[model samples]
Target: MNKKGYSRSFISLWIGEIVSEFGGAAGGIVNGLLLYEITGSKEWMGALWLIYFLPSLALQGISSPFLNHVIKEKMLKNIQLIRSGAYLLPLLGYLSGEDYITIIGLIILQCLLGLVQPIYASLSFSLLPDLCTEKELVQANSLLDGTLRLMSFIAPGITSLLLIFSPIYVIYIISSLMFLLSYISLLQIPQNSVEKIATWSKKFWWEELKAGYFTFFQYPHLLKLTILSSIVQFAVGATMVINVPFIRGELNGQAWEYAVFSVTFPVGYAIGMLLLTKLPKNNLLMYSGLIGGGLSFVLLYFVPTLPLAWACELIGGILFPLFNAQSAAYFQREAPRERLSQLSSIRLLFLRLTMPLGILFASVSFLGINTRLTYLLIGTFIVLPGLYFLIKTIINRDSSAKHIRNIV
Candidate 1:
């Protein structure tokens, strides 16, 4: 498909992503705030996210094989519609008057959202190629990424303002509406030709699932990259549980201050996106991103004030895009298009699988730790993987040099 430009389809998807990012970001704040208001425990927070992560990752692994047969845009639209519906569950729960029932409702809502997110994400990822050319792929991805981050950055400020005028539940309503808008925007995407896939037997479905896993193993480099990325995901999961508590409990901050702290990272991320395209593309730079990003969190752990913590988040955000954008581009370029959807799901499965573990790690009260220490621990986990790979590359380079010298 010699697609000449960013056609209506890609543009539509781009707009949808923008709206969706803001919606998701705002809703994330509401979730944390709402849960904390009710339970006041980091353990519940961890469990909340675990509910999201466990099924989300499990389904990503389970559903990879069938994605190829699915019509990407239609699947995407359905997911958005479902997401919009899911946001209402919490709002409905709150209105029902029973505290226990509200918590259970939120849990069920998270479970359903988790079930659908990977399907939407993976389909959208694999659909991009059909919408644009190789030259445009990186640019397209960068635009989508930067916009998402920028929206996330902007959403916090908006959320902070909204909180002044409205109750927390209103955010869920807004989020639901945003997803509806995203669905409406996506409706503008031009329909593309899709190949009909025959239904395989139960045994064949199992075979396809195995083949998807085997493909990841077959491409050792992809597997390696996915593992390295997962380290950061694990840390992010921990951070998700700790960041709010670290600000509120340890730093003695308010919702506004936490909002500022959250915005700083994505602001840096937006700036980082600008730099990502200008910098030289290499594995070293990408690896450095993991190290740099991890180091930011480590710095956050030691920060004595909100301003310093905000700075750490900003720097981390800036550092991450260097890795995130380039790694995504590499995968899109390398993965076989026919199997790309399957492989991308497998990749996402790897990335998202450890997040729940990280949450558990952070929430382990029996470990006798604080949020600051949790930050340090997870940051170290992220850095160590990159450090290992960097050292391995150096060792292999020196070994090759010695072999050539001996041959000469």
Candidate 2:
């Protein structure tokens, strides 16, 4: 820890993450907006996300076997540079003056982006502990998680403003430049010596992967926490699909209304981020966040008007960071430093693997269920498990306390 309470490296990495997240978020909004303009199909919007998720997960599986050998900082810089190039590719297609070709270019961009995102995300998540002391881990994680979300909200507001005066494609141009800046900022981090690389052998690689998974499963709390977190990710996936449509389709909103609805969650998230550091980091708080967030969704199911729905999202956003920041810090602190990167990827694989399932769940109108009911279902999924964990944690604590008292 530094006298300023955060290391210079963490500050550097945090700034880079913020810039990169903003760029990514801006590019994402542009991708959706441009693609929707071209196709005007809700199904295609879902498909675009699938293109990103499927390839990303496949790469995560392929890359996890070898992550222990890679240098984190170098790989982060390389991925950002590649992302910069990838963001620029669609412009080339636009310049070529073919809508179909531009669409194909966008698919190609998404595929490349999918390939790199898992590695970048896992590396950065695992690398934070190295940048900050154990004491600083929770704050660091909160800062990163909170700001990444804040950027997601901030980008849309910025995009909405820019759309008023400029073209949507212009956001992509800005995004490409933003990523380049992230790459430059990443260069400030001093590199560490690379870990000893494992020699190549088919059998050896397979065994290493099994060992990573085996070790991951061995940590019962970690496994449990991961599964619980996966439920939230599932809810998140559904939200990603439902948020815009629910606000626009069901509530009869336009771009400005959707933008306002979008911004509130992250605005609440920023406030939660500030509040998390002042609160206790424990299972009770984490599970409360899970339950509170889920209830917020259930609240939306019955919200009779647009303003009420916005408040539901705001409350959900505020409630979730309690779990997100603490759980992330716990994962970083719990995983062994030597294997942290690989384990982090494995953990992410499990968490991310479910989101597509959730997206698919949300995308499909199962049995005539409305979008609000879909939100209710996803929320219920989160709430039930949260209650289970909350009860379990309390029971265990009471049992431990009783045994202590009996022994005394």
Candidate 3:
């Protein structure tokens, strides 16, 4: 263990994730840019995303049971190597000097990426318990989550700078190299620390899949936490569709102002990560974070100025990690060791499924929802439920205290 209280394995895993995340983020930026540059049609851009999400979601649904039966460290390393190879396809297509080949390569790249991400995410999440003590989980999760958010924020700026000096296809090479670096970093983790499950059986796969969902439903708190996270995801999806219109069109903001608006939430989230380390990880902080974040969204609907909108996002960012890091730690600490990977996959699937729904909710024209109204609706969606849970927690605490007094 290091002086920072994290095991060497966890640190290795964390470092690998940081490298890979930056690569993935940078690649995502170029994917959109290159595709739009080629087609010059919004419809084609949307179709490209659909290609990624549809198969991705399909795999997320059926892949939970597989997670239970594999070695996580090995799978994670494999995924990185696979991703490194996948990034090369687009570069290969570009060198052929054919737009059609480039498009096909993009389609295949997205499909491959979509297939592996859920597995990688669920395995890493479930593997955390083995790599760190239960006590270290919250801080460990905070560090990982914070850095990921930081990477997403940093990668775009770095990619933009790289574009000035290099060809767009060169970013793909950089992404491929980054994933290779991540694979090498992950190799430092001792294979003995990760438990190997019995070989998976095709005949029993359906049964295991059903059992995974059944076990997930067996825990009400787990269900509740997952739903809470989904609501957040839903809010995120809606914001993605509407935030540009809200900031640039409605508020008459410049491109730089909108960029500031985009980044403030993540910057605040980074600050919140530091705050989480000092605060007690209890129901009070968790529920308050949820409630506060929801309120920030609610405030966005009422903000008249661009600065106020930025503040709302910053506030949401600062408050969300309080709930996020702790809730994730709670899940990892509470889920059964044997089924953690399976359950983590199921939990992830639910969370992944909600964002698209949010996007649809915001995008559908007949819904008669305006930009501000969309904010209000999704914000209310979170706030009402957050309040119910927070009140329930308070009541449950009081009831337990009273029962203890009667026993005394």
Ordered by lDDT, highest first, the candidates read: 3, 2, 1
Rank candidates, TM-score, best first.
3, 2, 1
Which portions of model 1 show Cα errors greater than 4 Å? 1-7, 26-54, 85-109, 163-173, 244-258, 300-306, 369-376, 391-408
Clash number for every model?
Answer: 0, 0, 0
- Writing each residue's lDDT as its tens digit, candidate 2 over 188-252 gives 88888386667879998989889888888878878888888898888888888888878888889
Candidate 3 structure quality by residue, lDDT tens digits, 1-408: 235788889989999999999999999988888888888989988888888889989989998887887888899999999999999998888889899989898889899998999999999999998999888888899889999998998999999999999999999999999999999999988875345555568868888898999999999999899999999999999898999999988899999999999999989999999999889889988989999999998898799999899999999999999999889999998889889999999999999999989988899831587788888888899889888988999999999999999999
- Cα lDDT, model 3, residue 231: 95
**RMSD score of candidate 1 (Å):** 4.5
Candidate 1 — what's its lDDT?
0.83
lDDT of 2: 0.86
lDDT of 3 at 217: 92
Q: Which stretches of candidate 2 lie over 4 Å from their true place?
A: 1-3, 32-48, 96-104, 163-170, 244-256, 365-367, 406-408
Clashing pairs in model 2, backbone N/Cα/C closer than 3 A = none
TM-score of 1: 0.80
Tell me the spans in candidate 3 whose CA falls farther than 4 Å from its real position: 1-4, 193-202, 365-367
